[model samples]
Target: MIFEFLLLVAIILAIAAVEVKDMLYAVLILGGLDLVVAVLFYLMAAPDIAITQIVVTAVFGTFIYVVAVNRTGRKEVIE
Candidate 1:
């Protein structure tokens, strides 16, 4: 039950993150949603995939956000 709820929430958040116009908020939410999916994967006994997701979300996702922020300039705000 809890896993199902988390999965649902993760999916919803992922969608919301993608649809959001604000780039920073979208990137943050995308990272969070990826982490949530990793947790769900752990709960489902897919430790390998879960670990991969965790690492990717923690490392690559942050890298992407940093690159994006650098390219866009920190002062610019997306509506």
Candidate 2:
């Protein structure tokens, strides 16, 4: 039950992330999604993979994305 809920929340966060116009907010949301995935991995008995995912996606991935967005200017292209 809890696992399903977490996944649902992650899915909702993913949608919210995509729907959000602000790049920074989207990046943050993705970080949350990555965190949920890490928890899921840990629950699945993959501690090593969970740790790797946390370091790679939850941490560095969001940082790199924010850096890139900051370098490029965070502007929503409304066409």
Candidate 3:
């Protein structure tokens, strides 16, 4: 039950992240989706993988996206 819910929520978040127009909102949503996946991994008894995903993708990946967005300005830069 819980696993199915988590999986569904993660899928929804992934879709939302992709559909959103703002890069910062999209990055935050992606980070949230990553956390949901990490929880799913933990529930599947893969603690190491979950931790790595949390640290590597959820944290660092989000940070990198935020930095990139900041450097380029929050809105899309069109020439």
- 1-79 per-residue lDDT for model 2 (tens digits): 8889989998999899999988888999999999999999998899999999999988889889999999987877888
Ten-residue region with minimum lDDT total, candidate 1: 69-78
Q: Which stretches of candidate 2 lie over 4 Å from their true place?
A: none
Task: Report lDDT (CA) for all predictions.
Answer: 0.83, 0.92, 0.93
Better of 2 and 3 by TM-score: 2
Predicted model with the maximum TM-score: 2
Cα lDDT over the full model 3: 0.93
How high is the lDDT of residue 36 in model 1? 88
Residue pairs with backbone atoms closer than 3 Å in model 3 (clashes): none
Q: Candidate 3 lDDT, tens digit per residue, 1-79?
A: 9999999999999899878878899999999999999999999999999999999999999999999998887765558
Clashes of each: 0, 0, 0
Extract clashing residue pairs from model 2.
Answer: none
Lowest-lDDT window of 10 residues in candidate 2? Answer: 70-79
| Backbone clashes (count) for model 3 | 0
TM-score of each: 0.78, 0.94, 0.91
Over 4 Å off in model 1, which ranges? 73-79
- Model 1 clashing residue pairs (backbone): none
